[model samples]
Target: MSLQVIILAAGKGSRLGRALPKPLTELNDGRSIMQQQRDNIYEAFGRDVSITAVVGFKSEYIVDRFPEFNFVYNEQYDQTNTSKSLLRGLKASSKGGVLWMNGDVVFDPIVLKRAASIIARDQSMVTVNTSSVSDEEVKYTVDAEGFIKELSKTVRKGALGEAVGINYISSRDKAAFIHNLGVVHKDDYFEGGLELSIANNGVLMEPMDISDLYAVEVDFAEDLERANLFV
Candidate 1:
């Protein structure tokens, strides 16, 4: 199956306190977060891999800047969260395996390669980083067999690690995945929707342990600075 990379880049990023949208924020290497992500995907999956970015905050900037990739505009991005943005992108994607990533995250291309490999067998996969578990991050608990048991920010104890917002949804689960995203309230994050899918909607979310790879989600100015060092 063809790999479809869906980038969720719709948020205004109020926490970052930047004029540019979070994805458009330039790193020290002079590439925007979104640009870096696109480049990494291309390097790992080759140029034929389909890429669709959900654009909202400064959507025109993204459209004009990255003409090579496809875009799905989130009209209510200002009023909604990542869940809605992701749903819109998912709807706009082609029928194939999906490798979705938060546009704000910066990581090596090896991470995408690993994700692509997992989606080849497993219908669904989620990246987990045991090293970065914190109070602020979304944590997950796994069964003894290593599947996700529970996932949330309030999960304090016995968690494997934080969900890095990079996930793989197989072509087989596309309908259920879309239903899961649609059921989630617009105000909730995409992680909340994923939780609902796992807990209630019966989505089999496998965890891809990525502690060996360097990955960081850029949420703050400090995070952007750290991501600069990463890219």
Candidate 2:
């Protein structure tokens, strides 16, 4: 089966407060966050997988800087959250399952490869990259079977996992999923819709533990510095 990737790059990076979008923020390796993610995905999945980046905020800057990667623009990005951005990319992708990821995260290529493997084995499967939770990171509640029961960045209880901002979705289910996604509350994050779909619509989700793998996602200047050290 062919694999496709949808990179959500529309966020304003308000936490970073940089002139550049979060995706365009500089990494320790001197490459932009977008460049690092794109390169990492390509390296893991190769040319067989179709990759489309969903860009907004500073769409022109992204297009001009990385002309090689395919891009789809989301005009309403300023008013919405990640769910909308993901829906836009899902609509534009070709007929195949997709690997959905956040533009702000930095992760090992092995995580992508592992997710692809899981998706290949089961078309209904969605994968979440998880790690040992820290006080500062977002957390997830999983059932006894390890399926994600709930996810929150701020919930104080029952949080044993952290979402690494990666997911897999089948093409056959994309339309229905995206349509249902349109009804999500405006302020909800992309994962909110995903958790709803998994619970209410019976979407199959799997977890991939990546505690051994290390990558730094930049949400603040401190995180940027951490990423520099890891990269």
Each prediction's TM-score versus the true structure: 0.94, 0.90
lDDT of 1: 0.84
Model 2: per-residue Cα lDDT over 9-52, one tens digit each: 88788999998778998877888888888888878878666778
lDDT values of the candidates? Answer: 0.84, 0.76
How displaced is residue 58 in candidate 1, in Å? 1.3
Off by over 4 Å in 2: 123-131, 134-137, 154-156
- What TM-score, to 2 decimals, does candidate 2 have? 0.90
Q: Which stretches of model 1 miss by more than 4 angstroms?
A: none
Cα RMSD to the true fold for all candidates: 1.4, 2.1
In terms of TM-score, the best-performing candidate is: 1
